[model samples]
Every structure is written in structure tokens, then in C-alpha cells.
Target chain A: MGRTWTLIRRRLLQAIPVILIVSIGIFGLLELAGGDAVDAYLAVTGGGDPAFAERLRQQWGLDAGLWVRFLAYVESLVTLDFGWSVVMSKPVSVAILERLPNTALMMGAAIAFSACLGTLLGGIAALRKGTAADAGITVGALVLNAMPSFWIGLIAIVVFAVKLAWFPLGGIASFDRPDLAIGRVLDVAWHLVLPVTVLGLAYMALYVRLMRSAMIETAASDWVRAARARGLPRLRIVRRHMARPALLPVVTMLGLQAGNLLGGSVVVETVFAIPGLGSLAYDAVSQRDLPLIAGILLVGTLMVIVVNLLVDITYARLDPRVTDDRVRAGGA
Target chain B: MLKVRDLAIRFAGRSASEAGTLAVDGIDLDLDRAQVLALIGESGSGKSATMLALAGLLPKSAKTTGSVLLDDRSILHLDEREKSTVRGRRIGMIFQDPGGSLNPVLTVGDQIDEVVRTHRRLDRRAARAETVSLLSRVGIGDPAARARAYPHQLSGGLKQRVAIAAALAAQPTVILADEPTTALDATVQAQILDLLVNLVQVEHVALLLVTHDLAVAAAVADRIAVMYAGKIVERRGPEQLVTDPGHPYSRALGQAALPFVAAGDGRHAALPELPGRMAEAGGTACAFAPRCPLAIDRCRAQVPPVVPFGDGEAACFRAGETAQ
Candidate 1:
């Protein structure tokens, strides 16, 4: 337990610099791209009353130096109090928190679906290597992997939502009556069908291919042969000896893929019109809502860091060879 | 007691035009309880294939036709489940490469414990205790600590000891050690051989030692069976086979075993080399006839039956003439 804690601590320390650099660079690029928020606001409001713009600028501390603004942003982040949104006229943190659960729901469902389906397919393919079933799976995974996520999402909507009338085509839920209970949950799931399936299919294809190769490689290892020679049952041999090491590489790939899901979700979310962070960020960009955009960026960065930390801890537990001290040092 | 009678194994080639090759053709062997038999042959002599067939570990494509009887029960007809029960419990096997045979990730204790658990109904803790005792029995000091170490942490000699310990975990009636010391250094090889010989003696287990080296076979085998192609061409006590070889192949192997002598010693005659390789054994009349300098017209067309000798057997038509 003590060792595990040490590893976690080391990983956290290492992530600090990465988070800082990424946030700083993203914040700088967004600021430079949008120009001064106060000046942009003044122009948008038709240069009406220089006095009102001046007062607004003073109240928001928009006149401060760039370094001062950066420090203020960092301070607000540490205090868990991101400033009010300039365009939406609401707290940025509140808006982000509202949309977070929806994104989490989609990502969690996609991961669970991909892992279960991919592993089963991969295991079956490995057991039947060189057979028609194996060749079909290999070719299918290649085709699925090549399909673009946005295009897949649109096609899913056309086939299942519009054509079949099986699911809702857009929006997280029926906007007429918003409820967080079972009925509303089903409604949201209906809307989630296109995006989640598109993302999951792509991820499943890649994972299946990786897992199939890993299983095949491990099946040929001498240790596996030794296990078979011991007269162990076939199922036991596959489960105990073959599966464990085969899954090691998959664990690392899954961790990296989890990070990618958040980044890559943007296209899928746009095609489905889901009110998640991706859609929120897209809206903020077009409207020049710097405060909302910055808030979304920070949230995305933090989520990625948290997911990485969880992966490191999970890896340490799964593989005994990965000690806490090494994890901590490596994480650093 | 164990007996392998008329054992033959053939494998189909990639094409129909090519005849199926016979790896082991009509070989016979007998081993009494607590007896040690050495099967000596070079690589590709079907020695390993015969051993695997006897153990019921042959590949799916291999076609074996024989009666491998363990105390009158024919093992060739047993199902996989029945064969497995007989394998680890009745006939334990130590493979050629100890390093490759043992699982690297597993602790030495865990590996041994698995064997005990598979054949017996001991709880985990008791099985572990038994594993430690087995390790200590194999001459490993600090058995408890050693049991916790992985295969890679142990030296080559220690790994072989672990393999022996695992093989002995079920208190098997017969132990098949296939080239057990082939990969070890000279001193380590001697120690491992001594350990095996001692364990077999103490356990009163029938030992089938397989090796290509005549010296290794001579070290511990009570009876030596010189295998040519797939058949045992000569079977006798070690001393008789070494000092008074009957078949030409055995005579050639014995002469080759003579130690190298100095260049100036006229008494040290030049070592005689065998004429040809072990022929492609395809249910041939006599596998060694192509390679034998003593081959006659009849040798090519007829398979020689085993002729009885004093407490042994030799398969050669000219055994009567060669005996004198």
C-alpha cells in the first residue's frame, strides 16, 4: 500500500509540468487568435458608448498585463472559481460542470462496449487463426478502422434514427421536459446511439486487432507450451496463462486510447449535436466566447491528467513488476 | 513394468504424391520396475518422437500404431483425459531444456505446487509446504526463500533442480528424463545426473533416460538401447554393449567413443567413422542397411527380428554369426 501511494505521488508530480505547459500554450494560442476580449466586445456592440466599454473592461480586469492575466487565470483555477462568462453572462465553471456528466456518460459507455466486444472477437479470432472466421474479422477490423468517425456517425443516424425511426437523431434528450430519471435516461441513450456507436466501432476495431496479435504471440511462447504440457485443461490454459500476458499490451493501449477519446470526441459530438464539451467548445469558438472556450480547454486538460493518473495506478496494480517507486519516478 | 511393442509413427507429407514418412518404425522396448533404460541415438533418429508417443504427447497429425502397455493396460487407446491422469501421476517427464520447460513468471514453489495440486487434493498452504520440502529434498538450501524466487532468479543448475522437483512431485512410478543435462556445463551436468540417479534410487521409480551421448548413457543407465533410425538395433547391459558390441552400428558407436590419443602413439588406431547417415525411415525393411558396411542383398529386402542374447536382445539377421 505504501509503495502504491509512492508511485501515485510520483506520477502526480510528473504530470504537473505537462499540465502547466499544455494549458499555458493553449491559453496563449486562444488569446492571440481572438485578440483582446474587451476590444472585440466593444466592436461587436457597435462601438456604442466608449464609457460603458471602459467600465466593463475595468470591472473584468481586462486592462491588466498579459502576465498578470495569466497569473489571475491560474489563481482562479487553483481556487476552483473560474470567472463569469463574458458572452453567456453566467459562471464558466457552472456551464462546464453541467456539460461534463454527459461527456463522461458517453465515454464510459463507449469504453465498456469496446472492451467487452473487442476482447471476445479477438479471442475467437486467435483461436481460429487461418480460418475463414479469422480472415473475415481481420478484414472487417481494417475496413472499420479506415472509416471516418464523423461519416460513421452520420451514416448511423441516417440508418437507425431517420430511416428505421429506432432512435433520436440529435440533442441529448427531449428538450420539452427535462428529467434526470429513467424515462429521461432512455431518451438521452436514444440520442447517444449514433455518436457512441461510431466512436466505439472505431475503437473496437483497433483493440480487436491488437488483442488478436498479442494473444497469438503469447500462445506460441514457451511458457504457454509448458502450461499445456502440464496437462492443464484447455480453458484454464487460455484463461490463466495465455490471457494475462496478452492483456498487458492491451492495457497500455487502452490507457492511451482513453485520452484520445476525449480529443477525438469533437467530430462525433458535432455530427450528433450533443451538448457535451466538444459541442460547447465549438459553439464558444464561433461566438468568440473566450471565457467559455478557456474554461472548456482547462476542463479537457484536467480530465486527461486525471485519466492518465488512473491508468498509471491501474497498471501498477495489474503488473506486480511495476513498483510504486518506479511509477512515481517515471510519472515525474 | 512398461512395454512398447511394434511402435510406429508416420506423418503425411504436404502432397499426396510424396509418401508418408515413417519416423519410428516397429520399435520395441521393455522396462521392469525400478530399472533404468537409456535410448541412445543422434538427432533426427526418431528417439524423441518415440518418447513422446510413449508419453501420449505426440502432435495431432502424427499417426501412431502400437501397444504401449503400462502393466498390461494399453495406453495408445486412452482418451486425452485418461492419458493426462496417467502422464503426470504414472509417467513424469523432464524435458531437454530445463530453462525452456519451466515458466519464467511463476515462483519455483508455485510451479511445483501446481503439479501436486493437479494430481492430489491438498489445500494451498499444505501444497506450498510440500513444495518447499521437495525443493529442499532436491538439495536447494533456504528452500522457503528459494521457493519465492522466479525461474530467472535461479541459476541454470537450480532451474534443472526445480524441474526435477516438479517431475517428482506426484511420486510418479516412472520418470522420463530426456537429455536432462545436455544444456548444463560439465560440473553442473555431473551434479544434476547424480541428483537424478539418487532420486530414482530412493524413490524406486523406473527411469527412462534418453541421450545422444554414449558417455551420458553409460553414466547411469543399467541397460542401454542403441537406436538407429527408429528401431532399437542393440539392447544390453552397459558394459556388454561398450566392450562387446554385436550390431555394426553399435560397434561403430562404441569405437567412436574411444578417447582421443596423442599423435605419436602408434598403438592409438585411427577412429572408424560410420559409412552413411540414418536413412529416411519409411517402413523400410531395415533402416540401417543403407548405412551399414555389413549390408548384404537380403539386408535391403528383409526386416530383422530381435534375436535373444544373455539378459538382452539385438535386431540383426547376422546376430548368431556376430555373437561369436
Candidate 2:
């Protein structure tokens, strides 16, 4: 456990510069793009005088040089200030905090759905390799991989939500719910079903392939061969000896795909009309809401870095040799 | 005792005639308690296949035709589950590389404990006790502490000891060591081989040792069988085979075997080397005839018949004839 913390602490420290560079990169790119709070405001309302735009730029410190503005932004970050969102007319932190949970909840559900069902399918495919079931699952994941999240979400909404009327069309909850808090939770889940499915399909497809190949390769490994020679029951061999080690690759892929999954949610969230960070990020981009965009990027980067840290911890747990290797490399 | 009669193994190809390699052709052997029979051969010679065949460990593509009587029960045709019951309980198997043979994530103790609990049906506490004791029996120090260590944490010799411990957990009557010391260094190799030899004697387990190294086999085996192209060319006591092999292939193997040179033979002399590699199995005539120096037209026209030479047999038409 102490080893895990040490690893996490080192990774987090390493992430500090990466996070700063990403934030500054975004800030610099926005500066180079010749956009500020005033241009975005004028782009929306139109007919703003040059003097008014200048006043607003100066007020927001957008008129400062890139480094000077970035320094101010970093200093504010120390006090947990992400600047004010000219588009949302609120503090950037407040705007992001309000929607962070929604995106987290959606992504958490999607990952949960993918990890469970994907592993199950991949395991079946691997165990019964070269069979019809393996071909069917492999083909199915391929089909899912080819489709876009928006297309999947549209199809799902058309089928399950609109045609069958089993779920609400979109949003976080049924506004006219006359039941208790538990009913609201159920309504939220019902609303979530389509969006989560859409967001999860691509990653689920990825995991299916990863886990299948991993399990196939892992089953062929020397230890698995040893397990079989020991007369371990076939299921026990698959579960403990094969699948457990096979999970390492899948876990690594989870961390690597965290950012991609969040990026995917932008389309899925907009399609389903969920009030999550992704949809917010979409609006933030169109309005050139630099503070809000920068805020989301920082948070997104941190989430990905943290997820990777968790993956490292999981990797160590699943394969103890990883810990020993790290120690051998002088606590690297 | 484990009696194997007319054991043969053939692997099917993608199609009917793509490969059809007879990996282990018809062979017969007897293994009694406390005896070591080493099947020595080169790579692709089917010596390893013979051991894997007895354990029913060959994949589905390989066709095995044999009668394996394990403690008087015919087990050649048994299903996987049924064979598993006989595998760990009646015939234990140790692979060449101990580190590879043990699961990396699991502690060596748990690995041994799993086998003990599986066959013995012992509860956790009792199984753990047996595991530690077995570890100690295999010459591991601080058995309790060592039990908690994973395969990666232990040295090569220690890992081999753990592999031996796992093999001996069920008190199997027959133990198959498939080049059990090949992956270790010279010093560790000898230590593991000695441990296996000692265990076979003390535990009274029938050992079917497989190796490509005739010297290693000669050092430990009571009887040695030299296989060429999926067929055992000669079977005899290790000493006799090393000194005066009946089959030409056995004689070549004896000369080729390293580190166990005959007492009177000049080690520095130009040793006559065997020509060519092992042939792919499946042919009408003698498999070794192409490489055998004593091959005549008849040796090529027909498969050599097993001829009795002293107390053992050699599958050579020219058996008992001295080769120039």
C-alpha cells in the first residue's frame, strides 16, 4: 500500500508540469487564434463598438501578453480560481463544478457497463476460441467500433426511448415526478440509459478485443501451461491463472482511453441533451469561452492522469512483478 | 507401476495430408516404483511427446493411440476431468523451467496448497500445513516464509524446489520430469537433479525423465531410451548404453553426450559426429536409417525390427554387430 502511494505521489508530481504545459498550450493557442472574451461576446450579440470590446478585453486581462496572462491565471489557480466565464457569466470553477458530477456519473456508468460486459464477452470468445461464438462476438465488437457514438445514440434513442417509450427522450430527470427521492434517482437512471450505452459502445468494443487477445495470449503463457499441467480445473485455470493476468492489458487500455472516452461524450451528451461537462465543453468551444475551455481541459487532463495512476496501482496489484521491477529500478 | 503399451502419437495437419506427422510412433515401456527411465532424444525426436502423451497433455490436433494403465485403470481414453483426477494424484509432471512452471502472481505455497487441497480434499488449515511441510521436504529453508514468496522472488534453484514440491504434493505414484533442470545454470541444475533423484527414492515414485542431454540422463536414470524420429532406437541400462550401445544411433548419442565421457575414451580425440538432423516422422522404412552409418538396402526397405541385445532391446537390424 505504501508502495502504491509512493508511486501515485511520484506520478502526480510528474503530472504537475504536464498539466501546466497543457493549460498554457491551450491559453497560447487561444491567444494565437485572435479570440478573447469580447470577440466571443461580439460574435454572439453583434454590433459591439471597438471601444466596448477594448474595455472588456482590458477588464478580463486578455489584453496582456500571453505569459503575463498565464502567470496571473496560474497564480489564481493557487487560490482555486479558474477565472470568470464570459459566456456563462459565472466563475469558471462554478460552471465546471456544477456539471462535473453529471459527466462523472455518465462516464462512470459507461465504463462500468463496458468493463463488465466486455470482459464477459471477451472471456467467452477466448475460452471458446475458433468457435461460432468467438466469431460472432469479434464481429459484433468490430461493428460497434465502426459506428460513431452519435449514430449509436440516435439509433438507441429512436429504438428504446422514442419507439418503445421505455425511457425519457433526454435530460437528467423527469421534471414532473410526483414520487420520492428514490423515484428521482430511478428517473435519472432511466434518462441515463441511452447516453451511457452510446458512449460505452466504442470502449466496450475495444475492451472485448483487448481482453480476448490478452486472454488467448495469456492462456498460452508458460504459467497457464503450468496451471493446466498441475491438473487445475479448467475453469479455475481460466479465471485465476489466465483471466487475472490478462486483465493487465485491459486495465492499461482503460487509462489510455480515458481522455478519448471523455472526448466521445461531447457528441453523445449533445445528442442526448445531457447537462454534463461534455455538452458544456461543446458550447464553450463554439462561444470561444477560453476560461471554460481551459478549465475543462485542465480537469480532463488531471482526470486522465489520475486514472492512469489508478491503472498503475491496479497493474501492480494484478502483476506483483511490476512492483518488484519498479523497486529494482530504484523506486522509479 | 505405470505400464505404457504400444504408445503412438500423430499430429494432424490443416488438411488431410498437409502434415500428418507421426510425432510419437508405437512404443512400449514399463515404469516401476523408485525407478527412473529417461527418454533421451534430440529436438523434434518425439521424446517429449511421449511424456506429454502419457499425461494426456497433448492438444486435440495430436492423435494418440495407446494403452496407459495407471494403477490398473485404463486412462488413455478418459475425458479431461477424469484424466485430471489421475494426473495430479497418480502421475505428477514437472516442466523444464521451474519459473515458467509456477504462476508468477501466486505464492509458491498457495500453488502447492492448491494441489494438496484438490486431491487430498483437505481443509485450508490442513492444506497449508501440508504445503509448508512439502516445501521443507524439497529443501526450501524457512518453509513458512518461503511459502509466502511468489515465483519471481525466489532463485532458480528455489523455484525448481517449489516445482518439485508442487509435484510431490499429491504423493503421486509416477512423476514425469520433462528436462526438469534444463533451464537452470550448471550448479543449480545439478542441485535440482539431485533433489529429484533423492525425492524419487525417498518417496518411492516412478519417474519418467525426458531429456535431450544423454549425459544428464545417464547421471540419474536407471534405464535410458534413445529416441530417433519419434521412435525409441534402443532401451538399456544407462551404463551399458553409454559404454556399448547396440543401435548405431545410441552409439552416436553416447559419443555425442557431453561431460560423461567413457573412462578409457580419449576426450581430446576427433569424436565421430552424427550427420544430419532429426527427420519428420512418418515413413515406411527405418526412421534413423538415413543417418545410421550401418544402413543397408534392407534397412531402407523395411522398418528395423526390435532385436534383443543382452537384457534390453535395440530397434536396429544390425543389433549386436560392432560398427567400424
Candidate 3:
């Protein structure tokens, strides 16, 4: 337990510089893109005079040199100030914070659903390898893996929400029932169903294929054979001896898929019109809101880094052969 | 006593004409308590297949027909469930590489504890204590510390000793060790062989040791069964077989194991090395005839039958004749 904490601490310390560099990179790229916040503000608030635009650039520090502006961005990040969003007319940090929880809720449920269901189904397929079940799952996962999340989301909304009327078409809730908290919560859950399913299905397909191959390989390992030779119960051998090692790959896949899910959320949230970071990122990109874009990029990068770090730790825990030193070297 | 009668194995997905279809063909032997029988042969000689047959550990594609009678009860016909009960409880198997055979994540003590718990009704505490004692019995020094160590943490010989400890946990009447020391260094091989020999005596268990090394079989085995082309060419007491091998294959094997200075003799000069690949099963005549130095027309025309010779058996046509 202490070892795990020490590893976590070491990883977190390493991540500090990576996050700093990523933040700098995001700001530098935005600066190089040559879209001053003054122009975006002018485009949003109707035409303004050149003198007013120059004053706005000076106010937002957009007129400063690239290095001076990047240092200022880093300085603000240290104080948890992500600057103000010229388009949203709110602090960038506040805008991101408002949207983060919704994205977290959708992604959290989606990942949990995919990881669990995929592992169970994949394990079954591997155990029944070369049989009809294995063929069915392999083909099904392949087909689903090829389909885009946005297309799947559109089709799901058409089928279940519009055609069958089983779910609401869009938004966080039935806006009329906001006064009743329970009803509002249930309505929001009902709204989440479509977006979560769309994001989850693509990940589930990859996980099934990844987990099936891993399970088959692990089952054929010498340790599993030894367990059988020792006369351990067949189920016990499958569960304890085989499953744990097989799951090592799945844990790694989970971390890799975390980034994909965030990318996936952009399309899913747009389709469902959910007030999440994905839609916020999309809007910021279209409006060229540099501060908001930089803010979301930082958050997204931090989330991915944290998730991958957790995956490494979990992988090390699963296979004793994996040590903190190896994970550090490999991660680097 | 473990009596193996006419034990033959033909793996599935192959007809009689298919090459390498039959792994073990019509093998018969008996092992008494405290006796060690080594199935000696080169790679692809079906020595390991014969041992795997006894414990029902052969792949599902294998079709085995014959009787493996353990104390008068036939085990060959038992289904998977019943056969599992026989394994570990009645017959324990030790695979080729000790390092690969044990789970890397599990501690040595955890592995032995599991074996004891599976075969017996011991509580967790008692099982742990039993594991420690079992480790000690296998000649592992500092058994307590060794028990907590994983397979990778231990040396190859120590890992082998731990594997032996796991097999002994069942207190099985018979133990099948398939090239147990093949992956170890020369010094470690000797230590592991000593441990196996000591366990066979101290536990009074019938051990079927399979190996490709004649030296290994000669050093540890009481009785040696030399197999060639999926058939036992000779089965005899160690001393008799080493001194006066009735079969040409056994004599060639012995000569191959001889030191450099003793390589020449007037009658058996230029030690005859067997030629050609092992004959596939269902051949009309002796499988070794194609490689035998003493092969004649009749030797290829008919299958050699096991003929008794001085308290042992050999399947050579001219058994009593000295090679010239």
C-alpha cells in the first residue's frame, strides 16, 4: 500500500512538468494560429473600430510577444486563473468547471458499462473459442468497431427516441420538470442513455476483441496448465489463474480508450445537445475562443495523463513482474 | 503398484497414413512402490506422451486406449471429473520446466497451500503449515522464507524443489515427472535428481521419470524403459540393461553415453550410431530396423515381440547374440 502511494507520488511529480509543457504548447499553438481574441470578440459583438480592437487586444494581452504571453498563461494557470472567455463572457476556468461534471458523468457511466460487459463477453468467447459464440462475438465486435459513434448516436436517437418514443430526443432533462428534483434527475438520466450507449458501444467492441485474444493467450500459458495439473477446480483456474493475467491487457486498453472516449464525447454530446465539455470544446473551436480552447485542452490532457498513470499502476498490481521502475521507464 | 497395460495413444485429426499421428503405441509396464522407472528417449520419441497418458493430461485431441490400473482400479476410462479426482489425489504430475510450471504471481507457499486444500480438507492455517513442512521435505533450506518467494525470486533448482513440494502435497501414490531437470544447469540437475530420488524412497511412491538424457535415467532410475518410434524397445533393470542391453537401440544408447577414452573396442569399435528417422506407427515390421546396425531381411519383415531375457525384456530378433 505504501509502495503504491510512493509510486503515485513519483508519477504525479513527473506529470507536473508534462502538464506545464502541454499548457505551454497549447498556448503557443493558439498564439501561432494568429486569431486574436479582439477579432473574435468583434465578430461576436458586431463591428467595432480599429482603435477599440487594439485596446481589446491590449486588455487580453493578445498584442504581447509569444514568449511573454506564454509565460503569463503559465503564471495564470498556477493561480488557477484560465483568463476570461471573450465569447462566453465568463472566466475560462468557470466555463470549463460548469461543463466538466456532465462530461464526467457521461464518460464515467460509459466506460464502466463497456469495460465490464466487454470483459465478461470476451472471456466467454475465448472460453468457447472456435465455437459459434466466439464467431458471433468476433464478427459483431468487428462490425461495431467499424461504425462511427456519431452515426450510431444518430441512428439510436432515430430508433429509440423518435421512432419508439422510449427516450427524450435531447438536452439534460425535460425542462418543464426542473422544479421537481427527483423527476429532473430521472429525466437527465433518461437523456444520458442515448449518448452513453453511443460512446460505450465503440469502446465495448475494441475491448471485446482485445480481451478475447488476451484471455486465449493467458489460458494457454504454462501457469494455467500447471493449475490444471494440480487439479484445481476448472472454474477456479479460469477465474483466478487465467482471468487476472488476461485483464492486464484490458486495463491497458482502458487507459488508451480514455482519450478516445473524450474525443468520442465531442460527437456524442453534439448529437444529444448535452451541456458537456465535448460540446463546449466544439463551440469554442468554431468561435475561435482561444482562452476557452486552451483551458479545455489542458483539462483534457490532464485527464488522459491521470488515467494512463492509473492504468500503469493497476497493471503493475496485476502482474507482479511489473515494477515501479519498469512502469516509469516504459511510461517515459 | 501401478500397472500400465497396452497403453497406446493416437491423437485425433489424423488417419493411420498421417505422419506423427501415434505418439505412444502399445506401451506396457508395471511400477511397484518405491520404484523409479525412467522412460528414456530423444525428442519426438513419445517418452513424455507416455507419462502424460497416465495422468489424463493429454490434449483433448488425443485418443488413448488402454488400462492404467492404480492399485487394481482402472483410471483410463474415468471421465474428466472423476479423472481430476484421481489426479493430485492419486497421481501427481510435474511438467518439464519448473519456472514455467509455477504461477509467477503466486508465492511458492500459496501454490503448495492450494494443492493441499484442493486434495484434502485442510483449513487455511493448517494448509499453510502443511506447505511449509512440504517445502522442507523437498530439501529446500529456509522453507519459511522460500515459501513467501515467487517462482522468479528462487533459483531454477529451488523452483524445481518447490514444484516437487507441490506434487508431494497430495501425498500421491504415484508421481509422473516429465524431464523435471531439463531446464536447470548441470549442478542444479544433479541436486534436483537427488531430491527426486530421495523423495521416491522416503515417500514410498512410484515415480515415472521421463527424460531424453540416458545419464539422467541411469543415475536415478531403478528400471529404464528405452522407447523408440513410439515403442519401448527395451525394459530392464538399470544394471542389467547398462551392462548387457539385449536390444540394439539400448546398446547404441549406452555406447553414445560412453566416455572418449573407452569409445573403442574390437567387436563394438566405432560405436554404431542409429540412422534414419523414427519409423511411424502401423509399420509391418520393427520400427528400429531402419536404424538398427544389426538389421537383416527378417527384421524388416515382421514386428519384433517382447521376449524375456534375464529378468527383463527386449524386442530385438537376435537378442542373445553379441554385436560384431
Q: Report candidate 3's fraction of native contacts.
A: 0.58
- Tens digit per residue, CA lDDT, model 3, B111-211: 89998999998999999999999999998888888888878788888888888888888899999999999899999899889989998989999899998
Candidate 2 local lDDT, B1-324, one digit each (tens): 688898899888789868678888888888899999999988899888888888878888888897888778897888988988877888889998888888888888888888898889999999999999999999988999999998899998899899888888988899999989889899988888898889889999999999988889989999988888888889999878877789988877777764336435544645667787666676889888888788899988988888888658998889867666
Task: Rank the candidate models, highest DockQ first.
Answer: 2, 3, 1
Q: After superposing candidate 1, which stretches have Cα over 4 Å from the reference?
A: A24-92, A158-195, A285-302, A316-332, B247-277, B283-311, B315-324
Model 3: per-residue Cα lDDT over A103-189, one tens digit each: 988998999889998898899999999999999988887787799888988899999999999998988767578777887888778
Write one digit per residue (lDDT tens) for candidate 2, span A1-332.
Answer: 77777787778789989987897788788778876667777888974889998888888777887678778878877677888887788999999999998999998898888877898899999999999999999999889989887888888889998899988889887779848888888888988988888788777988999899999998898777767667878888888888888888888888888889899989988999999999999999888888799899989998889788888888988888888777556464
Q: Counting only residues 3 or more apart in sequence or on different chains, how many pairs clash (N, Cα, C under 3 Å) in candidate 3? A: 0
Q: Is candidate 1 or candidate 3 better by DockQ?
A: 3
User: In Å, what is the interface RMSD of model 3?
Assistant: 1.2
What's the number of clashes in each of the models?
2, 0, 0
Task: Tell how far residue B97 is off in model 2, in angstroms.
Answer: 1.9
Model 1 clash count equals 2
Chain A TM-score values for every predicted structure, listed in order: 0.86, 0.94, 0.90
A155-208 in candidate 1: lDDT tens per residue? Answer: 888899899988888878887755658878787887787788888888888778
Q: Each candidate's lDDT (Cα)?
A: 0.79, 0.85, 0.85
**Chain B of candidate 3 vs. true chain B, TM:** 0.94
Q: What TM-score quantifies how close candidate 1 is to the native fold?
A: 0.83
The TM-score leader among the candidates is 2
Show pairs that collide, candidate 3.
none
Candidate 3 chain B: worst-modelled 10 consecutive residues by lDDT = B259-268
